[model samples]
Target: MKDEKFNILLADDDPDDRMFFQDALDELSIQATLSEVTNGSDLMKFLENNLNKLPDVLFLDLNMPSKSGMECLSEIKKHEKLSQIPVLIYSTSANPEVVEILYNMGALYYIRKEGDFSCLKAVIGKALFLCRNTRLIQPERPDFLILVDDIRPKLPL
Candidate 1:
């Protein structure tokens, strides 16, 4: 699509992280329409309600109260209508085993939340690009995770 505002959905419980995310997007000056949900349950509810008008991408936090991102990811992938929305797992943890599981479960990318705003913006930008280029279909093994220290295409099994 030419000259379109990217539709983005973010599900994170941390107020600070949510604010930082907004700030980063503003700083990047990305043309995007953003939506925020504080928990996984609400996130799923939003998706169910907006099935006909799903966001272009979802930035999911792996940690949250009630329903976890892992649970939501499973639900989303199983739902035919929601499965096409590319999901980026945004979180603070950098567990390699967890990352591998999420990647195998069908998340397009797993990104460790960056502490620096500049880095956050860069990572967000890179993620958006990937979402644009690889919606629905899972990325190859070499393009699965983005850690604070390094962005890895391959996760050790």
Candidate 2:
């Protein structure tokens, strides 16, 4: 089946990371129109300026300068105009505390930046597929970041 094209946005401070992310998207099966910003402030500005052009998903890095991802997430959730955009925390840190914080804050997913390009391709593809089908709905802790092959549902007996 032919897949639909999706608009995706990434906000990260690292130049290399942005380039790598774009390259990863290039390898995906689905067509994605990706745009980027370098910091939390730019992300917000872009969203505000393009109120009617919000992306299908937003990949937000947590450690950006000017403003942190947490700050951006808070701002986005508080604003009625921007709250529906699905936010995925894209950061290097996989600290339990940080993950819990973001998960509780309504982030749909959290991905620790993998160094391998193949892994990046797989993760991004999976994220896109999942978001496209589910509207990037927030998953519970156990199922949030697990691949489809690896998830074991905790079904009630």
Candidate 3:
């Protein structure tokens, strides 16, 4: 499994944020293939069309043009075929109330988008590592929100 490439799907409307995510992933030591969709509707279409090959992990943004990430998350969790895939909420805002709601909605993790490249790399790396090593289950509230600056000690890649 170490040599196998992970499939990652990101649904973000912001072009700059998408580019930043790709750049950060490119710098990581892990081997991964990233697919992007501009909005929630496109994301659902992609997932529905690729049922046989769903991404290992989904990095979903909260805000979008069409359906919101919260809506997508709910739809995914309710769908039998899509429920198993782990979803990590990737957004700029980290409101405590919203985080709590997302957690209850079955989001595997919540990662606050950072401006620094290093922080982005670190958080992305950590998220990928966890998704690979841990079971696809929602963690406790304490471990649900992944803060870029809160990260300490190098995670094993």
Candidate 4:
């Protein structure tokens, strides 16, 4: 794992969000390869096609065309082959109810997307570090949300 590049899949409909995410990852020190899909349908297809080489983590957006992130998440969780992959909810909505629902549904983390690049970089770096170093697929309820302002102090740099 140390020598291998982390594989990340981003499923987002918004072009700007996708670009922002890529930029954040670029600024991080970790070596990673990112694959992007513009919509949910394409995301699923990409996953299915790459079963032998599935991504280490998936950063999924809440709202997408063809299928919502919730729908995709449900399907991913239900599938035996796909259930082990860690999913991080990367969305603008920080609604508690929705976060709880996603957490219960088996998402590893919920990150509320902020416009600040540094915040985005911090949260993404934290998520990647956790996924790579720990066996914790899903954290306890209180630790589920990955807010930028709240993350820096909690995790090691």
Residue 34 displacement in candidate 2 (angstroms)? 0.8
Best by lDDT: 3
Error of 4 at 112 (Å): 0.8
Model 2: per-residue Cα lDDT over 1-157, one tens digit each: 1267788999999999999999988876678899999999999999999999898889999999999999999999999989999998888888888888888888899887878776666677777767888745687787665342342132111
The C-alpha TM-scores of every prediction are 0.89, 0.90, 0.95, 0.94
lDDT of each: 0.84, 0.83, 0.92, 0.90
Model 2's alpha-carbon lDDT is: 0.83
lDDT per residue (tens digit) for residues 28-87 in model 1:
656998899999999999999999999988999999999999999999999999998888
Q: For residue 121, what is the lDDT in candidate 1?
A: 74
lDDT pick, better of 1 and 4 = 4
* Models sorted by lDDT, best on top: 3, 4, 1, 2
Off by over 4 Å in 4: 1-3, 153-157
Those runs of model 3 whose alpha carbons end farther than 4 Å from true positions after fitting are 1-3, 152-157
Q: Pick the candidate with the highest TM-score.
A: 3
Model 1 error, position 132 (Å): 2.5
> Candidate 4 at 16: error in angstroms?
0.7
- Residue pairs clashing in model 1 are 142-153
lDDT by residue for model 4 (1-157), tens: 4556998999999999999999989988889999999888998899899989999899999999999999999999998889888999999999999999999999999998888877888899888888888785588999899877787677444
Q: Which stretches of candidate 1 lie over 4 Å from their true place?
A: 134-136, 147-157
